[model samples]
Target chain A: MKNEIKIFSPATVANVACGFDVLGFCLDTIGDEMVIRKTEENGIKITKIEGYDLPFEAEKNVAGVSALAMYNALQPDCGFEIEIYKKIKPGSGIGSSSASAAGSVFGMNELLGKPLNNTELTNFAMKGEALASKCEHADNLAPAIFGGFTLVKSACPLKVLELPTPPDLFATLIHPQIEVKTSESRAILPKEIPLENAITQWANVGSLVHGLHTSDYNLIKESLTDVVIEPYRKQLIPHFDDVKSAVLEAGALGCAISGSGPSIFALSKSEATAKAVQLSMQNAYSKSNIQFETYVSKINTQGIKTL
Target chain B: MKNEIKIFSPATVANVACGFDVLGFCLDTIGDEMVIRKTEENGIKITKIEGYDLPFEAEKNVAGVSALAMYNALQPDCGFEIEIYKKIKPGSGIGSSSASAAGSVFGMNELLGKPLNNTELTNFAMKGEALASKCEHADNLAPAIFGGFTLVKSACPLKVLELPTPPDLFATLIHPQIEVKTSESRAILPKEIPLENAITQWANVGSLVHGLHTSDYNLIKESLTDVVIEPYRKQLIPHFDDVKSAVLEAGALGCAISGSGPSIFALSKSEATAKAVQLSMQNAYSKSNIQFETYVSKINTQGIKTL
Candidate 1:
């Protein structure tokens, strides 16, 4: 079937709260769309963008790499004409790069009669992420491919599981007008952590996992606190802790830095709490009087889909 | 109220195979007893064992310290005559010391009209373990206090939860006749793990907790793997890999070191599989000219109770 397959890939919050390097959840706020059509060309060629500018080169671009990886897995000779519409910004830290990669793989696989399982597709998408980040970390790729709250159990062989996300789970994303490079933020983390801090991190990670599975909002709030990474990364975001505090005071379940960011995610149990959280975020940045965008979204259960 | 109280504290597997610092489970096979009398001495006193040359001094003996800690917490100026009857072997790596400490707290708390919560009594029991090992680790104390499979959510504040045990779950313990000093075993573990390994550990920890809460047997088996700790500790246990192979080959779901020890545990789905596992362990050790004692046990639900 050499037909057009249009797919949607949701934005994701990687390094979800306490689960650094292992957890993420899809966001319903924004996503990217990719249309893959079988073409006569020898390789994947990304055609056009509906919004922002992204590389269209076959080998250099993330979407192109993602399509190539999938094609190589099944039929290396199959050519794909991929058109990507980037709704999420390229450097936005809300899994910007993953959306393109996920959309490409998802659309291409659908067009090709669906040969790969979600895990296999995740592996292909992860390769695309690896091409851009120079490392195969599955934190972003899992949620983008499988949706819901996801955990990348292993990055090497790519074991991604869709965990049971809490019902009434709402997320508020506040992206301040600032650029924080993912590479730079990652490099800033200390190469070695004190043994005491490592133990504490693992304990919190355990608790967070428990909270997520049990839907214990209070435990999740307690578990979201990062004593090791966020302290260092918050220096990059103006009014970071203030924003967190304000949202929490406004009845957020928990709040923490959303990836390597000028953005932060606050969890709330209800739409009203989410609205209050949105206002709190605006007020926190009002001191700097900086313009910021806020998104009140239900946790995205349908990750990447054909649109 | 002056009364005779008989309390039974179950022996526990501290390290819980995969979860080195964060998990443990109580077992019914072995334990100790402490009989506390409301004496008018106005201070805590330890009466030594009938046969063995165990410590009798208040600060030096584990049971005495536990009783004293409870007294200090509750009455602050009361007398306790604690008699120790240690049944769990001294260096079994099956939380023998924890049994004594927990038994002391259980006996005295009953005698003191239960003035403390389980958490509070656990805190008191931990003081005894601290005095015994000179290290403040809670793997043993958690299960001994709470029973079933337990998770140590926090160390500083001592948060412990009793996780549900699956009905089909069975464990086969193989205590090889060898002595590996707890301190030496502890020293062999690496101080730092790759961030990747740490993340995988947490993912499994989450799955394990979920498995317990939902009674998912396969999930429990899947979660019972150690990528961070067991690989390093294998050196201390002779024929470790071979024993694990034997256990698994005999249809055991999972197997690993029981604690900081010369003992190992294999979990299975049925009594037959458990018996097969026992034979497998015995066969593996016998091939290496080593003797081992094996016990098959279901998860203990009642932690410390009057026997």
Candidate 2:
């Protein structure tokens, strides 16, 4: 076919604080690049893999799975070769797998003259993630593919909403030297919840959405408390409480686990607070001799792009 | 007292199904009217009471207590004579007490030449509720004072947000003869909730808020389910399950107990569904041989109006 299409997908913060499987937002720091080429062949195949050591098998790799799903659905006659350059670290709280998955669908859709809309791309990308993670979750993929803070309402009807992120939200994320296996983390969470706490969590979640829409900083702060996952998950992260306290004491609005564990994100109003949060994380980690890399960046309103 | 002001306070729905103590909305169906006049005396006095044979003592009766709080706060160098024209039933589960409290504040605020903002009025109204219920909550008063769907973020600092109501939404409310006291209803809820259920509720609540803001009908329908409160509270309402089933079967978008309810509310897309819901409630209530009154109407967006 000899058709070439290039696309970029941003790194994403999945399970944003309290929003376990429902909320995600794009990150500007790291991402993946995928280049799709159509050739005169029977089916799709993976031509190249760069940046990280991901699978070369087109059906097993995240990017490959996503691209293959799209190809199968669209039933493109031309054979396509996908080249994925995965920059984000796989198995990190930052959506590495989702980026690759999103990148594959994004590139393939572009290569096929944009047959699939964002929703369709998100579904195809989620199917790709399911292939890798053994579960279908699209919070990360949707935002990475579509941009902005996104909510995945359902997987069946595939309802996705791109929420407007607050303007002055400077996020400070610290990924400690611990690697939390996604499978292990997923196992620890309980399936059933007591009725009352569930009600409160939803109230805060509703408030959080409203805060984003209205730009109400105080509401955002109030809604950021994760009474569900963080309470149980924080035990895995060293100095989680100390780091959270330091960030809040240093003028950060709220702090919580990023996705599952190891990575913690704090929000601040100004550059000073952002810098302070970065320092606070370093300080908290220093006492425990736990080294961590921190990112002090603004909200990534723009998700993925053609680069 | 000859020179004072009269104000109208709208009916409010507290413990708004999925959002207990956090969400409330005002309605135009039932309300209370209060007249406050400055007299030569040194303290507030309730000269007249109508609708319900409530206590007339200024510090004890909800209307009288609300007026007393406002009078004490303002310290206006005059005693006030209050007349309450209460329309909301005493045990209607439709924010009956809140209407009395809010009416007093609205009336007193008007008499005081609108000295307080809506937030301040809500505070005084909540104080009145505290005197009546022994609990200081803002859910009902906030909406009654502010109008529309409201979220009370912090009761201490007093933050309230009026959320966008879903469009083309009609409601059918059926009030049976049974009475479920708020205090008793609250006691039944479990204090601690499971983490998983909390996450699900938050996800749904987040989606609900988005649905309201965006006016997405399907999202609203999906978000309206209460896994936390409705199941437990339904036991207190006679024929609750049948009423809910009938309403849903008759084409209600959703149905739930209205507040700590013997009163149930069902939402529908059109007036036809609203009427159908009313008939369904009647059919369900027929089993108990308890005659019920049903109101088929759209959301009373124009909350309180001067007659």
Candidate 3:
């Protein structure tokens, strides 16, 4: 087996529009780089972390927590060392913690000669995710691991389905540098929603999945609506409606808050349109004096890759 | 255009498992037959009825109501007369009323030289459906018009999507000879449902649509679950759990109440398995002394067809 491996783990957008907590997709060009080394000694350690101020303790850190979970289960003959070169920002709502959580296990699994499947890896990664978000979730991690679009069909059983990615679809994301805690964002949601609205939400999800499979752009545009989540969560993000309208006016197929808020993502049929969408989002928020970063990329079909 | 047309409008299984009020499919070899004839008279009429006691008034009967809806929209050069050969029994929960409503507009549109498309036909059919169910719904009508599996993606400004049908899939339906009114079933449901359950429901719907598009039987089985409406509505059906267990034990891919209830449907991977599922459903209900009718049929890719 290889003694070490360097890999790229992609960022992901969870709670995709009408999908709420169930759907997410990965980005190809945006993510974190990690190096996993099979150490001579006997335990897991976070040797280095860069780009952002984060904990280096193995148990307290997201990446270390995930690596430790997998290590404890496998009981490998050798200890491991992890180095995270972070690029995705925390509290950005584009699944920054998930990228960290998934990258560690993915790199370690490769170093261990691929002992675990995506589902098994996701469970371990979710353990790490829970530490950061206060709840175990797979929507972000599944896409970060499996690539493309993923549906966390059931949380308890942890069923994750990898949905198809339309060939021409490109995602444009704008992250307004703002802190929107996942827990507080979750608190504002109503415990119960009208049954009629629920039906509309599911119907949109059903059609959206179909749209992806068939590469029907019109259907995707029509189905990319969130009646259950966005109406409430949009309140937390400044210029949410303006950005959404701007992207739609820029010819985006669909647009919505990426995960919880602060970051917004829009899907368009071409790279040109995606870039145009980025400019529109820029225009929408630039005047508001909110510092932001934008990215335009195709759907990542390969989750974590050896570098 | 033909002066007269005789058509078979297939019975549909709506509220399909996880896709409440959104998903449905047409069943071959099971439906109602109607003969629609263009007449010199400038109005619509229901000339003959057979096999059931039903209203013959042009505006009162579902077929007449749907035909009149289309007739009024077109104000065609001629009137039409409809003769019903109703085979799907009313209050059977197998979209009996939808079959009738769809059949008339389908036959009338044929005689009128295909003036309108499936979406237009669905809109007219939903009007008649509203007369029977006291609500405008397209789950049943959409599939009956579009053929195969369909998702009623939106109710207002009705957008219906025709989803791909898996080749090996077969349906087994059991209609218990008991009354389960749509309104009563609707009354039993809570106006608001837990947000958590709604998430589960939409996740299943998203996966189920994926499964159908990819023809993944295992994914289909896993996704064929209803967490929102089934729990409350299944109570109105006799021996719902017993029959479900029986069908699942017989190697059926999935099972759920067809539409509102009293009728249950199971999907299997093959015609043989579907027949076996029917037998299992028979055995489950046979001991209870409930009069029932069972059917095994492939998906009707051709919705309303000429007889």
**lDDT of candidate 3 at residue B261, scale 0 to 100:** 83
Q: How far off is residue B61 in model 2, in Å?
A: 1.6
In terms of docking quality, how is candidate 2 classified? medium
- Candidate ranking under TM-score, highest first, comes to 3, 2, 1
Worst 10 residues of 3 chain A by lDDT: A154-163
Give TM-scores for every candidate, taking all chains together and pairing residue i with residue i: 0.90, 0.92, 0.98
lDDT of 3 at B202: 91
**Distance (Å) between predicted and true CA of A165, model 1?**
1.3
Candidate 3 structure quality by residue, lDDT tens digits, A165-234: 9899999999998888888899999999999999999999998999988889999999899998998899
* lDDT values, one for every candidate: 0.80, 0.79, 0.92
TM-score of 3: 0.98
After best superposition, candidate 2 residue A173: deviation in angstroms? 1.9
- List, residue by residue over A144-228, the lDDT tens digit for candidate 2: 9777788887667788888878888888888887788878888887776665456556667778899899888877888888777
Candidate 1 regions exceeding 4 Å error are: A1-6, A36-43, A76-81, A111-113, A289-291, B34-52, B76-81, B111-113, B189-191, B213-219, B287-291
What is residue A172's positional error in candidate 2, in angstroms? 2.6
lDDT of 1 at B159: 85
lDDT for each residue of candidate 3 in B1-307, tens digit (9 for 90 to 100): 6899999989999988999899999999899999999999989989999989999998899888888888898999899999999999998988899999999999988887788999999999998998898889999998899999999988889999999999999999999999988889989999999999999899889998999988999999998988888889889988999999999999999999999988999999999999999999999999987899999999999898998
Better of 1 and 2 by lDDT: 1
Residue B170 in model 2: shift from native, Å? Answer: 3.6
RMSD of each: 3.1, 2.7, 1.3
